[model samples]
Target: MLYLSQVLGLVTLALWLYCVFDVITTPDTLCRNLPKIGWVLIVLLFPLIGSIAWLVAGRPERTQAVTRPSAFPEYDRPGRFAATSPDDDEEFLRRCRERAEEQRRNAPGKPQDES
Candidate 1:
């Protein structure tokens, strides 16, 4: 019985140590919003409750692969024109519209223009 208790204690200690090491060495990206050292103290000082806290609060969130740029990606990047809008210039858009119409006329299945 005493041997069994000793073995159980050793197992618990090993689990505690592993949790400590894992939390401490985990990178910020893998651990979400906590410092590794902070995890160490929590797991060390309060074992059961702290480990539970780490499980619930410190686990990493999975990020999805971003396949394309967002429709409004320009808002966050650093640039001189970050606050400006191309739509503010009407003349620039008039030329663009003319070019689009020209391309559409040249595309397949388009009827030829008649004077």
Candidate 2:
């Protein structure tokens, strides 16, 4: 049983390493809510639990599908929304409000928005 346990331990270590590397290298969009660096740090600092955490909950939801390079045609265009602003979220909200005002002005009718 000791020999079997040793093999199992080694296999677990290999799996942990694999997860750590992938978590580190994948983009923030790929990592979703959990920052990529934070995930990598968690895995590196707490190998056993971190690996399990990744397997159970760390991976982003499939709402953002994985890009398969093999599936892309030679003339495939890059994604448009790849850039992220770590800056003020208020700016985005401000833009949304401005757009709504403009749209309302352009639209025919009274603007009775309750917001």
Candidate 3:
């Protein structure tokens, strides 16, 4: 019974300390119900109940995390291989050849004979 009480006391102390630090570190805007300083005072004055109150009422509500788009979006998928080199891509080669042919046909040096 004595050991259990001691353990409980330690737990309560840890909770109190955690609440105090958490309140101190938390941003002023995020704190709810009361101001950040008020929450800190509550936790310091009333150990167990204050800590519980801080957790329940003063702590900021969790928002869904926003994932930023990656610069290399191609590699973001699971179970995927890296993209093939441009030289190995048939479509890329075909496009390059078509572009070259179009440029050749439109060459400025070529004389156009008008009918």
Candidate 4:
């Protein structure tokens, strides 16, 4: 009986601590019902009841999977061309070949055999 009570007390303390920490850490914008400071005070003042209240009313609503914006915004723009492979881009390969040929022609050195 005494052991059971001890266990229940520990559980309550854990719940209270968790609620307090959660209230403190939760962003003001994300907190529901009451403001962040209000939630924190509530949790701190009434351990069991406040913890339950925070869980039921003050916690932020769980959102479905959030689609974050891409780190490279330019690549995510609509109508942007995205090539799967450089080798598959014929226009890009042709430009590279033209640039290489121009560089070879303008080389300032003894002309080697063009094999």
Q: Candidate 2 — which residues are off by over 4 angstroms?
A: 68-115
Assess each prediction's global lDDT (C-alpha) against the native: 0.73, 0.77, 0.88, 0.87
Candidate 3 TM-score over all chains jointly: 0.54
Arranged by lDDT, best first: 3, 4, 2, 1
Q: Which scores greater on lDDT, model 2 or model 3?
A: 3
Candidate 1: stretches off by over 4 Å: 1-4, 61-115
Kindly give the number of clashing pairs for every candidate.
0, 0, 0, 0
lDDT (10s digit) by residue, model 2, range 1-115:
5798899899889989888877866677777557778788888888888887876677866676777675646446666454467455778878889999888877867766576
15-41 per-residue lDDT for model 1 (tens digits): 777777768766655674577777778
Report the lDDT of model 4 for residue 69.
78
Tell me how far candidate 3 lies from the true structure as C-alpha RMSD in angstroms.
Answer: 8.3
Identify the leading candidate in terms of lDDT: 3
Instruction: Give the Å shift of residue 102 in candidate 3.
Output: 35
Error of 4 at 9 (Å): 1.6
Pairs of colliding residues, candidate 1:
none
